[model samples]
Target: MFWRRWCGLFLDQKRRKKSDATYKNYKHILGEFVDQLPASVRFIDQVNADVLDSHMRYLESEKAAPKTISNKMMVVSFMLKAAGVATPSKMMELPTVEEEIPEPYTREDLQALFKAMTPEERVRYTFFLDTACREKEVAHAQWADLIDGKYWVRKKTFKARGGKERQFSPKSHETRLIPLTRELMDMLNARRKSSKSQRIFPNEWGDPEGHFLRKFKAVAKEAGLNCGECETTISEGRFTKHPAEVSCLTRPVCEKHYLHRLRKTCATFWHEKHIPIRTIQSWLGHKSLETTQKYYVASAIPRIVPPPCSYSRRICSNSSTLVLLSTRSSLGAVRPEAESRVYGFQ
Candidate 1:
């Protein structure tokens, strides 16, 4: 069968079982693969070792990340296998994909990001940090999903008038419950009383908001937290007919600023609070505990400690004298205070 025909068959098999995002991703990968195929290679059987190698080379030439390349290649292998062709493993070696370390946002970074957001944006992002839910899960969350002080992540189906069906489900099709803090619960209750839509957060059209990452980057830029070094080519308004390469310095397109980092930060916070790996995995709705350990449990908290001398200069720059005061407090009650003085020259 032709490459496109085989790809269609494979996608049809996946369409019913996979989530919309997964189905779209698989379709995109297969479409790209078919597009990159040589004209001579029409049938699945014509896809030999050399063809796989050439495809890998094309992916590398496009400067795709190692993990992305591996994922695409895996999809290609699946397609070939579904078509009863020999898989790439028997003929060629796959590229090694390095394990990526998760980088969660620090308290300071979170503060800056929150400071840059509006009141409405803060509430939306606060839900992200408190729940550690994926973007889609958060977007699709409804008041009905919250039951007895816990938020349930589950599959939801929407039926169209023409008998067509659309479904929204958690990643891996795993449904789990996450407990919320009292403060968050109180806030949510207030919003619930005032909200007109069924969704906890909704756009002007009363649908789940989808363009969160773009707004997040804007907040990062407004907070002056953007790295301002990364650059990419993109097309803008009608005035700019041609795509222009731009830097993050001019545009709010920093790689470091994203909604997922908030999720990672929340997971890391849970880990730091002595939460068990299995529990964290369940809260994250991960099918495997290894994912929680590999990404969240092993993530490090960013820290910066200044030298002792620098601390004095930085704290008391104008004065030659420094007084260190310590206080003991319990339950908002002050107990005692101790004072020490140090003389220093600027």
Candidate 2:
């Protein structure tokens, strides 16, 4: 069978089993692989260890990240296996992928971002930072998900304007309860009274808003948080002879300002409060405690201990208030008596 035909069959199987995003990713990667194949090799049987190695070389030459290359190789290997072709053992040697440390937003960054947002936008982002919910989860959030003052993350079915029902599931199909601070609860309650849609944050059409990252980048740009060195090409039109290359200095494009960073920030804060690894993992809805530790809680350990009887108070950068208090022992020794207290915005 032709290579493209075999790939089409494989993708059809995936289309039924995978999410839309996953299916699209598979199609994109496989399309790139097929495009890179030599003209002489037109069939699945024509793909060999040399072809696989050459593809790997091409990916490396393009400067793809090690993790990205590994993922593409996995997809290609799966396709070959499905086509009844045995992949060479030598070709299975994947590159080492180092886990990157998480970068949570700093207090100053949070302050600046919040300052650039309107009141409604501030509340929306505050919900993101406080609950540590993923973008999809937040988008699909509804008042019905709240139970006993905690938000429940689970599969939900939403109906669109045309009466088409779509089901949304959490990543890894794992569900957990997320507790909300009193301040966040109050803010949500106020929002609920005025909200006409079931979704906590809905668009004008009463559906989950999907342009969060774009709007967030705009806010970050307004706050002067963009890294001006990054460059990208933008097409003027579909048939434009030449696209214009631009730098981040001309656009609000920064890799650092994203919703996931807030989730990491929340997890790090819990870690700094001495929360157990298992607890943080559950709160993060991570299937593995190792994932929670490696990505979110690894570098949050306090490096220095301050003296007792010294209290530090600061307005929460995200429009809240936080205070750290310590008391002197009866024996005249100073030590922390309790964890830091965080108050929500009034």
Candidate 3:
């Protein structure tokens, strides 16, 4: 007794586990390859390396982003693997690992966005973006689970571990706690009166809403919270076009991809803070730090402090310190003890 589109291929649980937009995007991308094939190629057996390479070429020619191509490949490979078909390795030659730099949110943008959001939505969404919490966990965060200052993220939803409905994991790793600042705690307290229900954010509907990509886009657009707006540099000034690359907020706008950009933006802010790669990995929920490195390479998170040479003595004392060190080395007194007494390193 299977339903339409089920095809006994992907089960309902697996499908629901993925966020709606991700599921939809995977379907759309996979269709590009599947729809072009003859019935023979659609069979799991036909999905060999050669066939996969052909699809990637089409994606490249059609101008799909590298990350998009990669995600599509993951979905296709996952589907094939699930059916016990060997996934071809040729799909590994992706479009050079998505090198486009991520645009970090401006201080103005962050301030305006958070101020625009209500205490609850702001707390929940920022925590989600910052910690890479699964959409469900953000929806169901509870006061009990949120220890005032610690690493903790309990899974009251998507309880796949045991009969217990809720489980604990850091919001970043969903397996360990990182750190919680006063900002988050204050937010919780502000929402405390309304936190009578178990959920940090309880939807009127009892169940957690499975679909929010569109809704998030709409809300983000209204609040100017999303950094996804396409920016265009013109003779007058640079400005962004709201929501899509389709229209312009100002005349003569440049092109930018928005929501995913925001994700990269979140990663960049964390990266710039000198956060460790493993920490960023946990924050992004990537199984491998290699995946996390891709983010640093892609986002180009600016170093919080400019290079010592770039700063004049007026700007930063580090440049002056370097000069003094060079003078000391010329005097042949380059030991740390000699410098420590003067520089106070010891």
Candidate that would win on lDDT: 2
- Candidate 1: give the clashing pairs: none
Model 1 local distance difference test score = 0.73
Error in Å for residue 136 of model 2: 1.8
Higher-lDDT candidate of 2 and 3: 2
TM-score of each: 0.78, 0.79, 0.57
Lowest-sum lDDT 10-residue window in model 3: 307-316
Q: TM-score: which candidate is best?
A: 2
**Residue range 43-117, candidate 2, lDDT tens digits:** 876777788888988999999999999999998888788888865445667789997656877666776777778
In candidate 2, where is summed lDDT lowest over 10 consecutive residues? 327-336
User: For model 2, what is the error of residue 31's alpha carbon versus the real structure, in angstroms, after optimal superposition?
Assistant: 1.5
Steric clashes per prediction: 0, 0, 5
Q: Scored by Cα lDDT, where does model 3 land? A: 0.50
Model 3 clash count equals: 5
lDDT of 3 by residue, 5-75 (tens): 32235534445655454566666655665665555564565556677787777777878788887877776
The CA lDDT at 191 in model 1 is 87
